[model samples]
Target: MYVAVKGGEAAIDNAHRLLADRRRGDRDVPALGLDQIVEQLALAVDRVMAEGSLYDRELAALAIRQARGDMIEAIFLVRAYRTTLPRFGYARPADTGAMLIERRVSATYKDLPGGQLLGPTFDYTHRLLDPQLAGDAPVAAPATREADTRAMPRVSEILTREGLIEGDGALPDDREPGDITREAPEFPMERDLRLQSLARGDEGFLLALAYSTQRGYARSHPFVGEIRIGELDIELDVPELPFPVPLGRIRVTECQMVNQFQGSAKAPPQFTRGYGLVFGQSERKAMAMALCDRALRAGEFGEDVTAPAQDEEFVIAHADNVQATGFVEHLKLPHYVDFQAELDLVRRMRAEAEAHTATPVKVAGKAAE
Candidate 1:
């Protein structure tokens, strides 16, 4: 027997209250502070910042706390908040080359100009848990010695030194760098917009797409040319501050990949570029991102293509997690109205077909004996 249901408003209110209670656990145990989440769950905060397109650690932390540790939900919170923020004059594009690099390594060169620094990585660490202590207090890290010497050159510079890699010198000027947020994507695009989408894309989605390439769904032999993580200086053109003011720094992850080169008779064989950037030391995400970027770039040059990753329109359009999650999860809402309509349509169609077949057809011509 079917029963009529009511109490939509009361049910929602009760659910909200329950959620609030759960979010803020026991009164005896202190509620998790935003700072505590930011410091302890630093990587999640990084993903929120990267995907949300904002660099505020406090806001990221708050989003994480509010989301109850759901990364995508935290990202949605940050993105929503970021839109409300006033547009101050744009900062001069960050010089990642001049970054106070914490970690830098290149697989392309064994010995480059600036030596490889494997700064702060869990790459080689064992993933097994150690139950030495249940409670461990945060402690201050040791200070580092200042490098008072000359500025370090990029590892790419060494490749440019030998004229192997393309320096940013020969770029065209006819087309301007389009802002993806400000404008809709127009076709016959450059590498910048494509990279932006992949960089801010959901980690899991990008990871799966990248994994497909390695699993023979799409094949592009790629080498991690370099991966760097560091504090990048933020220079803002503030009217109040007038001169380019230093707006502190934020940690960043940068990955560069060297992929298989396909040359035409007209042009010499040159290494193609795949680049990725995130807010923190997310090497796996960055590497996956780089592969996707390289795959998309296949359309730019006339590379023999037969892969899902190589589809430019499909990749760029669907890469946004915020959009995907919204459309996907929106189905969970009251779709009973739509579902009922579909159910009626299918049942009626089936009944009509059955009756028509069962009834002796008015023969246009003589029925088969």
Candidate 2:
């Protein structure tokens, strides 16, 4: 059959136009609004915001729509947009102790000072899909009696109160943070690199890695000290008070993992920490992240580490999806040029092999014998 293969520029331009048309959909149908996406696909927005490292709901909603609900694409979009934003002052660390908590749970304790509040979760729900969701649903409110905002101490606080558990404050300050982005990771990294890996690491990958550790990769037994969802105060550096000034509030999920620790000669036994903080109600990711964080701290604990999650170099190296995707997709851009070079090399090697076969080598000792 006769065929024509030509016009690369026109083909690419046509493809781009078609993509725009498909993304926009029919002319009769109105473009999906940001509010609609935000209201309907909140969880997607949450994931985008968490992964994108940005907190603007509107921006996140826009990214979700623009990326067509592909979370990684949404994250890429947000990150790209984020780079264009003006550099602002960094916010000081948010305080969890003073958080206006919505959901608080502790696996370590049955009952604690601050009672567990199961705010919004799918944990105990039956997996069966409901047909009633087709209609507009009524907004459900918490029971009036259960809405009290009483100040409550953490479950771990009781352990500290009785001197039963050793906190992170007990750890020696000899170890320093390793910067993963600025420098390449080396063996025997510090806690900072591990935390950074867990922070940006793929949720599923980190979960599996964390699971492997619990499934007997690492010897430490991790107890979820506290899983808290709340509004934490964002403070900014102000020269006036010599302290961080409270700027605003942002909702976050903070998971503090308390792992068993044995005392060494230099330091007394205490509960070493693995902390995970994420935007929104991503408790599972936070918990998984915390576990992975603890696993990665194996080197710091002076233990024989053999877990995939514990390899700081490997874990941190593969954690960022942005880096991973860029390297993986760059292969799609014009490798025919490289293929031609490789083809030339292979042809030359074949020609040399044919020449060598045609010219037989001398059999010296055997012929003489």
Candidate 3:
């Protein structure tokens, strides 16, 4: 049992005031609005929404403001706020195939049905800051065109048609998904839990885990089969309604990685897949997620599970940045009593050793004459 300490209320209040002042900054400058954050700094909001497990961009933008642009802290705020909202009903799973793709690219095939569309990307742009961006000059609008209406066939489906890739026939979408927030993950978990963990996992941690696999530790030899960034419609099935009603649409990023699988005694050689889906245009996060997803599937694929990324317990357990940071940061809190007890024990041990050393000569002989 720990006793509560009194005082520091004034200091805590002052600290909060100081934080607000720092967040606002210069009085002459215009205050940064939530809308501006949602519009201009959209990537940051997307990250918060992805990790926070909340879909509302407006709330995510507000959280980013309240957290003063600390993404992790904003994520924490969003997660906490999300729990308070009532669950009306589950929405139907998004149809990725029908997504209105704005950006689509493939690394596996030289040519796809819809030749790679580099819609909007920083891939070719030189990393230079334009001086005009600093001023209030009117920014030019980008050239717009009608999106390609042709159906973008999935790269995985194409590979599977040739029997080069394995397929999961008739997926059980109605099956209950494991909620990481509600329940703790167990070993040998279902695929849903693994996907859930990676979906909300810290980007940096996932990136490192993905990089480890590429560095030859549990290497899966993966290729970006396809990556699609687009807005997907979400619908909910109302029991009274004849058909599912459209709720709205959200921007998402999806990555499908093709991996080589060597034939084993029981199974024949084929290509497998690793999938990643995030809330927005997070290509790097999605790519890293796909690689980690593959690495975590070593057990199911008959590959060696020696690496940290391959260990289910290690990866899923530490994937949550909130849990990891909370446990680690708890050290900053008062531990004086515990430290005192340790100090007492250490001092006693040292004194006993010193006393034993000082009295040692009398034991061997009569005053060592």
Which candidate wins on TM-score? Answer: 3
> What is the descending TM-score order?
3, 1, 2
Across 152-223, the per-residue lDDT of candidate 2 in tens digits comes to: 776667777766676543334675455554578676655666666567667777778788888988765899
Question: How would you encode candidate 1's per-residue C-alpha lDDT over 116-152 as one tens digit per residue?
Answer: 7778788788987867546785657966876545566
Estimate the Cα RMSD of every predicted model relative to the unseen true structure. Answer: 5.7, 6.9, 4.7
Ranking by lDDT: 3, 1, 2
Compared with the true structure, all predictions reach lDDT values of 0.79, 0.77, 0.86
Question: By lDDT, is 1 or 2 better?
Answer: 1
Q: Candidate 3, 44: how far from true, in Å?
A: 0.4
Give the TM-scores of the predictions, in the order they appear: 0.88, 0.84, 0.92
Show pairs that collide, candidate 1.
Answer: none
Better of 2 and 3 by TM-score: 3
> In every candidate, how many clashes are there?
0, 0, 0
